[model samples]
Target: MEGVLELPPNVVLRAEDLSVVYKMPRGIARVVDRVTIDFRVGRVTAIVGESGSGKTMMASALMKLVPYPGKIEGRILFRSDLLGGVVDILKLSPKELRIIRWREIAMVFQGAQNSFNPTIKIKDHFLDTARAHGLDEKIALEKACKLLELVKLDPERVLESYPHQLSGGMKQRTLIALSLLLDPKVLILDEPTSALDLISQKVLIDLLKDIHERYHMTMIFITHDLPLIAGLAHYVAVMYAFKVVEFGPIDKIIRNPRHPYTVGLLKAIPPLRGELRFVKPIPGSHPDPVNPPPGCRFWPRCPLATDVCRKVEPKMVEVEKDHFVACHRWEEVEVSKLWT
Candidate 1:
């Protein structure tokens, strides 16, 4: 606990070329491949793509939370080499991982509805978490009260109530509070608002933004909703198959997408009043990651794919300063004229 006070606000997480692979019933499946990214000192980075894009898989690799039957590869550097040493998540012992789980890095899951304990009182869960980490019952209760208050929940009622007693929104609020139990430096949220109503979703988004400002913690948001991510993230990384197809500042990636898969994604999202009408949802489904396409995963559905696109894997190429895209014909392919 004494060491917690000295941790500063900076680049708190570095996931270098991480990968998560599962050898399933059929064959080898690469859920996440070569995912190299970071969360900054006090900003939000959103990983946006359609379902099965492997955004969630990449998030799991960072936390070393990928379950059994799956293997994680690559380095997870906590801080820069000078201040904090690099720790390979795959190599860490459970005891060593306990220190990182919630105290240093926390997670807000997409399906909070399924995460709560039915038999345990909600307050007991938070208190128990604190207790497990060496805090006494009384002190844990007090801290739990503070944590719930931050999320705008009634501490007393929630402490005594069971998971079923609370509404869906309330449960998620509780989960958010729990993820911040030890004032974590990094928070990974996977579609935190997917299960809530519109009003509740807005409330949670506002609460998260407020909390992000207050804690100045690095956050990585994973969601399929493009508009939602656009409003929240400073930078966005777009995924197709198990790899990142595009990664750059939000404006650049959103306004002028280079990857064909990314362009197809933008096409799927509806536009507002007078907005350009270029985007048309790319038809057909994503290629199965278990046995992914040899060349481009999106090639089967990509209308612009040429013969070469079907033959060679496209590496992420620098299209602009700070803008990386993985597409073979991005330079010559001009689809900008389609939207008008």
Candidate 2:
């Protein structure tokens, strides 16, 4: 179990029993299991998981942008000072969702730079996105300049450059600028620093911290990089096999994670200032989403799993004050050695 960081009453977004199912010729595959989470205003919550763990799908479901042939279910509630009331995103019509997309909520997608058209200049991309939301070219240009500066980019040079002319870092910064063009309250960043160099990744991390503090925006950072989130995020959600196995404050999770899956993940991180030691990766692969095993999703790879783990589904339990773990043998598992 980990410790919980209680947020203020001003919650910007919440997902209740959120699930995404894909329709296949054989049968439906549930990619994102029933995940419920509250993203507070002005707080950074990082959702960390390996590939195929449904982290990106969770972000996609938040924006109602899940790929076609995939159907989303459950309540995605969004409350903002701009909206003046709590709105259920799943219930919103396509037109209404569009209204909220950039102005009220924005997403910086994974490989977002690749989404840019090679033929178009970066300035046109920003102008076009802004114009779609009804802003004049003049206003769009001014906002673009300001956002580029906020992201530590030279507005003049970046705006004039094409997607291919800029470096990877510059392209990423441009995407960030575009996402903030409407000053949305909630920004969902899906692997914002994925393919960049280490230096560029650090720069992006610093820029994100600045943006969160400056705009007081609720940022949901989706990535598989657990180490990167340690200092940057206030809260963390550990997902496996499409479900959240453990979640709480960053410090609590780092110091006292109760879930075996979470413990395995922490063990895999190489310590920066420690005696050189071998890092053990989590054993076994994540279950197939379409034909996942019964009972606890992590049971197959969990070392402490028992007979009960193979039969009854383990409900999420509060093992420590505000710390939740969804494993029957959480108390018996000893993972404290990883941190020490």
Candidate 3:
């Protein structure tokens, strides 16, 4: 399995055979399947998939924050500077995990409104987070102010105002600032541009790009938007039905996607500047989580699926240097004109 192989030195975090299962009244729903992927240091990796493809669940699993009733199984090895070595997040105690949450890895959740306390002022949020992490109040305040400014918000005004007083864009930017307060090495953002206007989305995207260039932090951006990652991500991991189907450098994935699902995603995106072409949505709905189809979960929707694909699960295999595809007919997919 890819999880057992020796990882490159640059890998800051790795998830090996990671799976998330929820024992609901209906049945066992595996939101995240046995997946293994490496996150390189100082690179922006985008986890792209449709809604309910387990993007958010996998991100939560990385931070050991899967809510009750959802059990995570597998190794989430993080190269921790605090521990002076690699540590499996799932193995860490609650206290140890708390120490690492913001100081080592922070998450900017999807909804900015829900992330903040309505009654408290913005500065209090910063101070509260710092206090929880045992950071000095004075130093934390200074850093918070600087981060607010970095995100193009006025510290004086933002710090005094409540969450309701800020615009959606302001709140989103503030959330980003708050996530950076502890200077975490890895930042996970779930649907960062959700519920934002076009202008706000563009601004947030630019801010994220600037933040990455300035800090060079390892970032995991979870979004279904394919075009959005084109301008932001260094690497792309395409997930389908709770499993990563294709992963490679952004350029390679964009120019030559080798997975049928990935090609479907690209074709679904409407082009703004190019020859006119019909936009075709990927044909089937997402698989039922509790009882997905047998063998290759995507075979039902995959145009090139053969008898083998319906009988045996395809393992992720290297199609090119640093590029992988988990498709039984990847060679046929590579030469197909679907995406081109």
Candidate 3 regions with alpha-carbon error over 4 angstroms: 1-7, 334-336
CA lDDT scores, all candidates in order:
0.79, 0.87, 0.92
Cα error, residue 117 of model 3, in Å, equals 0.4
- Tell me the TM-score of each prediction against the true structure: 0.90, 0.94, 0.97
Candidate 2 wrong stretches, greater than 4 Å:
1-8, 81-83, 337-340
Tens digit per residue, CA lDDT, model 2, 150-245: 989999998998899988998998899899999898899999989999999999999998888788888999989989877789989999999999
RMSD of each: 4.2, 4.3, 2.4
Where does candidate 3 have its weakest 10-residue lDDT segment? 1-10
Local distance difference test, candidate 3: 0.92
Best by TM-score: 3
Question: Residue by residue across 1-340, what tens digits does model 1's lDDT show?
Answer: 1132222345567777888989988988888887777666678888987788788878887888887888988777675232255455556678877877777778887788888889999977887788777657787777789889988999989989999989999999999998887777778999998978988888888888888778787889998887876667887888888888888888988788887777767767778867675556677888787888878777888778888889998878888987888888887644464322
Model 1 RMSD vs true structure:
4.2
lDDT score, candidate 1, position 258 = 80
What's the residue-level lDDT of 82 in candidate 1? 24
**Candidate No. with top lDDT:** 3
Residue-pair clashes per candidate = 2, 1, 0
